[model samples]
Target: GSLEHTAVLALVLAMALTAAAPALCFAALAVAAGGLGTAVFCPGERRSGAAVFTAGCALGALAAPNLTGVLTLGLAAGAGLLGFLLCPEQALRAVFPPPATPVGTQSLTSAARKLSGVADTLSDIAETVNAVCSCQMPPRGESYDYVVEFCAQHLCQNCARRNTCWVQGYSTAMDGLYALRGALEHNGRVELEDLPGQLSTCVHPADLCATVSHGYRLWCSRRQTRARAELLRTALTEQYSAMATALAQMAARLGRAGLPDPRREARTTQLFASLGLEPLECTVLTDLAGRVTAAVTLPRTSFTPGECRALAEEMGRICRRDFDPPEVTNCRTVTMLHFGERPLYRAVFGLASRPAPPETVSGDACRQFCDSAGRAQMLLCDGMGTGKPAAVDGQMAAKLTAQLLQAGFAAESAARLVNVALGLKNAGQESGATLDLLTLDLYTGRAGLFKAGAAPSFLCRAGVVRTLDGASLPMGVLPTVTGRSTALTLDVGDTVMMVSDGALCDGSAWLCDQLTLSTRLGQSPQQTAEAVAASAVRRSGARQDDITVAIVRLERQKS
Candidate 1:
């Protein structure tokens, strides 16, 4: 718009000048040029094209003669006006076509630049390939200096553009030639007609043969390396998957074994020993034992009665064991002293038997039996590391703790026993296990909590959560010392949660918020867990450490 206006004004002034003074032909020419130039070069109104045009015009006008005289001034003004009025719209349109409609101008420009770079690079590669091919000497050692000289001459001719294309092109051509030569050398000479299709297409067979021969050497050299790495990765993945499956199975088995004190290693050792296995075979057999132990013990701390029962049922199925159905034989009104409330810690029991129940039952079975036998002892342990070793550690901790707790040993003494076992097993090594032992007197609901390097337990009362920070070094790390047990009392509707570090690090606050939002929208736990897991995996950006969580809710006993 500005350019158009300027053109119009210039034409008007030029016409006025011509009308005022017949002698000012130069002024008319200058004004016409200014207007035409402005109309041609000036961009859209938003641009400074019009201002540029005006400045050029003013400078031209200043150099014109007779600017002070009335006649000359009148002529100049008239010429300027005439030039502005006479400037053709058609001429302006020719100078500036309608702006091209583009999806994205910046993107198009970037794409163009990329393509241009690729094209330049390819051209250089082509030149290099041609040079190498042309310089190939025959097997008889015929001189190929002429071909090399020719390539050198071309390189000199295009020296400025050489770096961009020549180096890359030369490298690619050399690679191709090397691959061809290596293939030929390894596979032996093929008839010109019987050569591979790729080789046949090469303009220089000698160079291609040399490349193929070189490639064959490289392939042969690294074949074992590539194969070994792949085999190792596959083995590792299989081991991981097998361990996970075993853990799941073991957890179910422990749940069904309604024994008063189920010992993980005892069961594993017995299982292996029954099969005539050596001591080293114990490692493989017990690979998933600890995980199972941890999973079984998890319910005591983190599961509701209903959930516990459900888990027990699942365990029975996996372990192919039968447990006495959970029965509420008598309603005993019991007040939990910890939170000073009356809650039902129902006495429940079921039996889980494999082909043969190990001499000792798992801690989970013991806890289940305790609930039924009117015993108040719960032991929790998390194995260090992951898979086999960690699972083993956890199993040992739970087994030892459960054994001592059932024997009427105090919680502190039981924890000390477990810690001693862990330290012995992992002597001189940094590896250690953590245990959360709780010996609850079902009759009074008096709890003796022994935390061994486990995260502080949480107590939920009246919808508010409080952490019980009974911090202690995990077992296996150090010798058992005094001052470990944290005695407390529980009340009705007070939920106690104990979990492995895996569970605590499962998801972030943002992820929890998202899960909460999904829950508010009525997403099921299965769905929530799936989403949480997926989101956690995504957020983690890599395979994370193991994850586990357990929640135990205590409710008033049903009369």
Candidate 2:
């Protein structure tokens, strides 16, 4: 069909050229047009069209008189029309196909730019908050001033000798009040004898002592409250700052990510068209690390499992990189499919947990999952003591940590933020949990262990067991807690085992032996975890604390 169109166009142009340049040979022009059309159209089907074009050229060259030439021209034109009508659909496609320009690239760049702007907004808010909080904080030596103000308001305001004690004898009254600081702080009260003679000679010495003592108590309570508030403010400030920095870095990385590959985009578009799927938008973003993420938006429709797999395979081929199956989401007007870079290695997790004696729920919580960044994370938290109360604390900590990590936060930031939340939950009561996290970068096999007052984790590699132990305070005990981080490399067949303190209460030797024996015997991670947890409970006899064991083993993904 395209060849026929080309012939019609070429012949009309030739006629125009002949009229414009009468000295030019008309037959030569026709021959050149045929060769040009052959080059422009597909090769296999060129024979019929080229021959018809050549006949026209030859007949024109004869310059025969009258009807003879006219008949020859009519025959040539009929032959060309026949060739055009017989052209294949495939050949037509070769002549005019999908454009190579990358679709949705501008939209992707705009999204990244918006993210950068959001980061800037967050930074501005954090800076503004930090400035406000800093200004509200009282100076270190102003506690005494608060005590004096309290005494003046609650005691001297009603005293008959108020002017004599405060205004006329201002210096004496101030000195007497300042001197009571040590007595109130150390002994919780001040005696009449503790006051200066000038103030002791007042009409109501006993009342003065009682009122001043009460004010001192109130001042101490106020100071404690302020201290807690200050700690909370500091933690929140740091969290906001950290969040802004992380978001900004992510935005910067994506904002300047390399241009989309035209070849890949064109091939992908063609494949979708072939599959009868009309995509509204399709974009492939490659980061500085060469990691690729593809997004395809289509009219809201469901996809069969096979169709999804087919799309993934076709996309992988187009990009020359393996892609995980697209995660599908349906918005109000469109369906979105997001494909992330698949990791080389996969992890299998196994967990075994049990409550302490006489309790139905365990005080330990564990989670195993993969983050959007392709990092496999396993979390274990041990609460303060065994019971439902402890279980609640442990579960809360683990849940919050998992959510933050999944949201793309750094491990340390998430832990610190959780710590601040727990520390401020109950004003006067103490509540805390130990955090033990194992993060594995599935793409690189690099592993990190982060611990906060939890038991040591054991790593079994090639029949040898290595201990990952660190001494750290539990969260909620302080204003902010920093988890201990240890990094190492892992590979296929290497297993990492984590447990609550109850598992290692009797010491780590038994668990180490169990892990090493299990590895040598080639037991599955689930079996090993169950075996270790049961043995630890048996060793505890009465089971004074909850027992939890989780193991993660790296394995090569089967293609």
The residue ranges of model 2 lying beyond 4 angstroms of the native Cα positions read: 1-97, 100-147, 153-159, 163-221, 248-259, 270-280, 285-292, 299-310, 313-322, 329-335, 416-430, 476-481
- How much does each candidate deviate from the true structure in C-alpha RMSD? 36.3, 8.6
Which parts of model 1 have CA positions greater than 4 angstroms off? 1-344, 347-373, 481-483, 506-543
Q: Write the per-residue lDDT of candidate 1 for residues 252-307, one digit (tens) a residue.
A: 53344222212332233343234343112111111122212111100112235684
Q: lDDT by residue for model 2 over 288-392, one digit each (tens)? A: 778877767777888887877887888898888887777766656767777777898999999999899899999999999976567899999999898988987
lDDT of each: 0.44, 0.74
- The true-versus-predicted C-alpha distance at residue 555 of model 2, in Å, is 1.4
Judging by TM-score against the true structure, name the best candidate: 2
lDDT of 2 at 51: 68
Residue 399 CA error for candidate 2 (Å)? Answer: 2.6
Worst 10 residues of 2 by lDDT: 109-118
